[model samples]
Target: MILSVPLSLGGLIATAPSARAVPSMARQTGYECSKCHTVFPELTPYGRRFKLGAFADSSEKWDERPWTQRLPFSAALQGSRTSTSDTAAGGTGSSDFPQNDKTILQTAAIYYGGKIMDNAGALVQYNYDGIEKRWGVEMFDARYANGVTVAGREMTYGVTLNNSPTVSDIYNSTPAWGFPHTGSAATQMPAASIVDMTLASKVSGVGVYGMWDDLLYFELANYRTAKTGFFRFMALGQSWNSDELAGSVVEGNSPYWRLALQKEWGPHSVAVGTYGLVSRLKQDANVPSLGANRYRDIAYDLNYQFISGEHSASSRLTWINERQRRNNAVISEGLASNSINTLKTLRIDAHYYFRRQWGGGVQYFRTTGSTDELLYNTGDSLMGSTNGSPNTKGWIAEINYLPVTNVKLALRYTWFQQFNGASTDYVPGRNASDNNSLFLMGWVLF
Candidate 1:
């Protein structure tokens, strides 16, 4: 059977390759990849169940142990072509991307994923970035879980150790694994939320999470900088830079949390959830002396799915609100007339599948935030905001085909309604629409 599902990137969400499905976990459980994912990384109810089951190692044959259970290894590569309404200036001298209609080998990776022991399982991704010309850790999610009876209801509880906040989520609705899975790394994007996008690769986190009666989910965790120097070697990270490991270190104990309520009846499943992150951070390596900045981010999300016979469908909605206290930045950078600022983002997406081989979807995304000229001034360039606002609004439409189950092909177009707070004359002669982009991608897993 083929899967017609929305292809998404590391939050970007897009399509991938399809084939006989012997990628990683399938090699361990002997279950075809389709049993868990209609689209790679997107989970079926059974896939969620498998993860809650500790990847099912306790159920394996008695003679099998982690070391002998097929190794759980796989590799994949990606390439893409990107065309913008306006081309970047001059040549691709940045060494991180290609120029104009040039297609690039964007990325390649090797993964060690699936069951680690009777009660523990993990997923580790080591990737080489064609743009950065460096290799380091990309993603890691390790968990240990157990089943219990609670007031006659069944529950699955687990502990998670990972590098990013939402990397261990079974649902694809979160920031860590939402759709539009890949894009040209060289493309220029407006500035993003520091709280949500940063601290992703630089820190190590540990948390406790649980699913109760298959209806309620909760988690709590703390994060700190992954130690530099030798820790990078362990991550295949560049050995030359130590400070890069921590980036801007998390001050004190940065806390993160998640909560959700879900229900399923007949062929439909739905969920509503809330999550948050709060961190105290030192400025940058150059100015730690200025003290710390505080960021508090809160989000609400919803997910829906319908499955019957040869077809499956799903949709997700999410919104995030961030409150920031910029004591150090206000004093040192003098960019703020006020000491507090806020940022908000909203995304809504829906998809439909037919016959399990083809699919299409649409997404609307908008970001808006406080205005502070000193903080966002980019000097009349298309990349900078004409005003001191963090406003961007756009729409994306996509079509995807999964010939088998391990590969995906897709075409995506994004239209900008507003960029960096302007709909017209963002730069001297450029409107945000001038930066509209068309991206074509090919992705595969084996």
Candidate 2:
């Protein structure tokens, strides 16, 4: 039984901060990267505010001329090498490509992003996957924000048009922008949940979000199924697959909700937040479904950062529990033993930056859930389950060195404790350790 992951984008068991004056926001505001990011993506206090404002703030003279005049365009290139403990079982595309072969041009992307008007800003990406040999709409967001007062408290409210739920978020601590920034598209992981693993590029979403008193944040949004043709609108090209889409095919509209509270004083800042979504989805797009398979996923997150002098430190933790009602799958497909199931995922990471040049971080991830024999009963095949289980755990450690303000070099190693639900006898003859991997990559944004 093959289940479709809801998001076209996944944590990828795989897998740029703009540094310096990114010509985009920096040129528009005359502010340097240090004013917004300690390292790209990782935000400073002011950076968060800038994002909350929809990247529309500027201290420089407003050029009434078309932004096309300034040409705030940029591109990113990634080169990486992947090494596994054991040779992979040949499958599709580069899934079985040589591991220690010459470095691959993992990915390439171009963007036309940044403020379009005083109250509007956009960040759109066009990506080309070298391994899959495909073009895709990586991420797209267009926002309209304004300053307002809600009940006597300072507030910033905005309406966002985006391709995914968390892609419009101000903080990078959430699942969509979590650590491991980039991973080998070739790496494989065990069974996954709809919320944590998928749900990035498969659907379209629009929501209203805002922050009040610099302590409270809330958002309300809805998502619907999207097709490959939509990418042409952003000039991001097309989808990787022509058959069925990579994200959940929803019925009607799916509701998404998020809330957070934060505090800051001196050089320390901390925040706690909750986000969830209720989706009614189906597996096959070609065939009609008996009924919608329902998934209600709820999550909690915590982020803490402290910056003082030349030293900076930060930590992020997120946990999600997804409740599944498999009535449709059981009645129509007979692929599940139980009418209900549950899946859970937890991730934690910490990073330290020395003098804003060298950085190191460690991350741990775990996934577990109740299983149905039909869903987790098979062998060592790519989609098989050695045992009737959906469980996996691993550790990732990485180090980074900035060769320049806009470029970074990184090395990461991942060790597996359990794969496909077990450590030993995980399959007929293989051990989980065989999946351990090492990845080295170079990332840049300008």
Candidate 3:
């Protein structure tokens, strides 16, 4: 059965028996992921048991017939604003200029999660954009897992229906589940719009493969790019000769892949992984300025965690190697272009919980690039370009309060700056200087 409801930008539904509940409910029941998961996000023997229990809890014999009849639903609402330096030009064209002051409804979503039968379950979500006046699917995952044997050893095969980013946010790193995080740098990744809320398959074909008792875990996938035209807005005009516009369609085979591994010894756990994309495209002959036939990137990340009682601390390091190859024809023609370009970034974040209700943390990020090739079309003959290459940095500090179990409220302040040697005459001016921005957001799940 399908149901719809108006929701806050970031709200999420609760249908599964294991659905998150109010803190009071959690305390009253005295249960945590540990009761189900072997290692927090990773399910364990008890975790599977809880899933089975969720199905049992919704049986016809249960007293809450209405709630048990369907799945749990959740929703979230969010608003954001920004401030920047006047030195920055919005991009190409007068229309592209970003207004110095702005307010936006960042997100609104609805989700359903629960079991379908004894050994199967599903998770589905829909997101609406107030500004766009449209709704789209964000996540639809169906999973099945059972004991099995491989190479004469015991193992399990689990399947999933969506291709969410492998590692985007640290706090809500469930991969294919959860509401949008308004304050994560990884959200800018290209895969954000393509993978989420699509009919992509993994697990049996592309999934973590290893023995349950092994100290390490790993994953592999036959990654396929999502359909083109899925995003709400296309930056470039519908001109076939426009290199910037035509290059936006990153369809065909992903040539993209991911690898993740982690090990736990006592109270310490460590994880490392890499994910990136490689693709080839045809450029418009009319627009000789755009260069390159192939674009590729490689990224690596490492994480460490120390857990003890209510106190926990974690840190992460990530590096990216992005390359844009220049087309010989374009360079010889003397159009605005470069040969090879690359971008690298490093970020560190940490969080500490106080009694599981209140917590505080900070995150820092630094990005350096070989060239300024990443550009977005914003319509009205305008484009948005990153002003700096070689260096950009940002930081976020926040405190979270969870009055009830399933709900969370947070306040955060962020600052970011970009340095550019030359600016353009778009909305503002050329020779852009570093700019700073601040934002505050609140999130909840029910």
When summed lDDT is taken over every stretch of 10 residues in candidate 1, the lowest stretch is: 1-10
- A best-first ranking of the candidates according to their lDDT comes to 2, 1, 3
Model 2 misplacement above 4 A: 1-12, 16-23, 61-68, 88-102, 194-197, 228-247, 329-332, 378-380
lDDT of 3 by residue, 1-446 (tens): 00001010011110101112212112222455334322223233333333323322233433234544344455655454444333234433223224324565545666655555554554554655433335655444445545566656655445443443342112222223222234321111110012111212211113332334333333344333333344222111123343423443333444445555667687677767766656544344345454335557676777666666665555666656666565686456543246565555455666666556667667675555554333221111122234323344556576666675445565655554332312233223432232333444444555
| Cα error, candidate 3, residue 323 (Å) | 2.5
Residue 295: error of model 1 in Å?
0.5
Predictions: Cα RMSD each: 5.5, 3.6, 9.2
Q: Each model's TM-score, in the order given?
A: 0.88, 0.90, 0.64
> On a 0 to 1 TM-score scale, where does candidate 1 land against the true structure?
0.88
State, as a TM-score between 0 and 1, how close model 3 is to the true structure. Answer: 0.64
Better of 2 and 3 by TM-score: 2
Q: Write the per-residue lDDT of candidate 1 for residues 1-446, one digit (tens) a residue.
A: 00000011112321211111227777777677777776666687888877766564433552265465557788887777777776543221233224436787766888877777678887777887765567777776778999899989999998887887776677777777666555454354554443433455566888888899999988899877674643333334644244432224566778889999999899899999998888876655445565676778888999998888778889999888888777755456774544777777788998876756688778898878787676555553545666767677889887888887777777888888987778886556667777677877677888
lDDT values, one for every candidate: 0.67, 0.70, 0.40
Comparing 2 with 3 on lDDT, the higher-scoring candidate is 2
